[model samples]
Target: MRFDQELIASMVAPNSRVLDIGCGDGSLIGHLSQEKGCDAQGLELDMKAVTQSVAHGLPVMHGDADAMLADYPDDTFDYVVLQRTLQAVEHPRDVLRHMLRIGRSALVSFPNFGHWRLRWHLLRTGRMPMTSVWPTPWYETANIHPCTIYDFFALCEEDGYEVCRWMVVNGNRQSRLAGCSPHLANLFGEQGLFLLRRRTR
Candidate 1:
């Protein structure tokens, strides 16, 4: 597991209920159930992923995240996770708002398309990025909308969502100290996990 995985895992208490949106192949859900004893359920759009989840004895529903968010009642789960899925959906902000309403907290993680390497590729080669992180031809990529690290925070601020914790993972960032090295944070913070709560104000 990477730092994002550790951050996501740390968000939920032991035996806490969780609902994972766009849960690919039920990997984390399986881990949470077997290792942490979490009560986990998953919502996935892909048939192959859903079938794989079911075969693993995981509670999974093949459904759209945008539509399915309205089905769950308020405060149904301790945590609602949107792992690497915000870009794929039509209305990410609406989804996040509803997720917070339906669960105590929400975790959102996305591949940062605004990484400097991606920027360099676009600027230098004038070609759509085809890297290890986002390995897809422009026409075939499932990513409808791409985003940056600060962009996500800006949305959270605009929509009155409180950021409980934000972890920018290069490999496994375990340091207590941080720096204002703008180049390092931007260039290296490839993936991030943002833990959010409803803003009371």
Candidate 2:
């Protein structure tokens, strides 16, 4: 399993239901079901990935995150997870809202655009920055709405979502940065992971 997937799985409670959105190859769900004893399933947009997941005896459905999320009833799962795919989605705000509506909590992880390396690269080159986390060329990348950690916090505050937990990790070092201020995290962290819930009135 990927480092981010392991972190997401750790956040989930044992034996709880989980829906993994954009679950490529269903690896996370498979691990969750077998290791954590959870009722885990996946919804993937890629047909090849869906086929591969099903072939592995995983319960994965071919579906789009933006369109298919609303089909689920309220509180249908314990967690709705979208990892490394938030920036690629067309309607991120709506997708997050729906995820929270259908699950008690949501886990989100994305590459941090405001890392100092990206900022320095852009300033030095006066061009679109490319790094290990953002390996694609600008023209070919699917990240239409790249955002920073601060931007995500702002969105959560604006939308009345309670940030239950958050952490930043460096993919190269495989080290986590927790209990740090958001400003520091935004500058140094390569990726951000958050667990959130709808704020109670």
For each candidate, give its TM-score against the true structure.
Answer: 0.89, 0.96
Worst 10 residues of 1 by lDDT: 174-183
Per-residue lDDT, model 2, residue 178, is 33
Off by over 4 Å in 2: 172-179
Question: Across residues 20-129, which tens digit of lDDT does each residue of candidate 2 receive?
Answer: 99999899999999999999999999999999999999999999898999999999999999999999999999999999999999999988899999999999999999
TM-score of 1: 0.89
- Cand. 2 Cα-lDDT: 0.92
Give the range of the ten consecutive residues with the poorest summed lDDT in model 2.
Answer: 171-180
What do the candidate models score in CA lDDT, each in turn? 0.82, 0.92
Tell me model 1's lDDT, rounded to 2 decimals. Answer: 0.82
Residues 17-50, model 1: lDDT tens digits: 9999998888888888888999999999999999
Please tell me which predicted candidate would have the highest TM-score against the true structure.
2
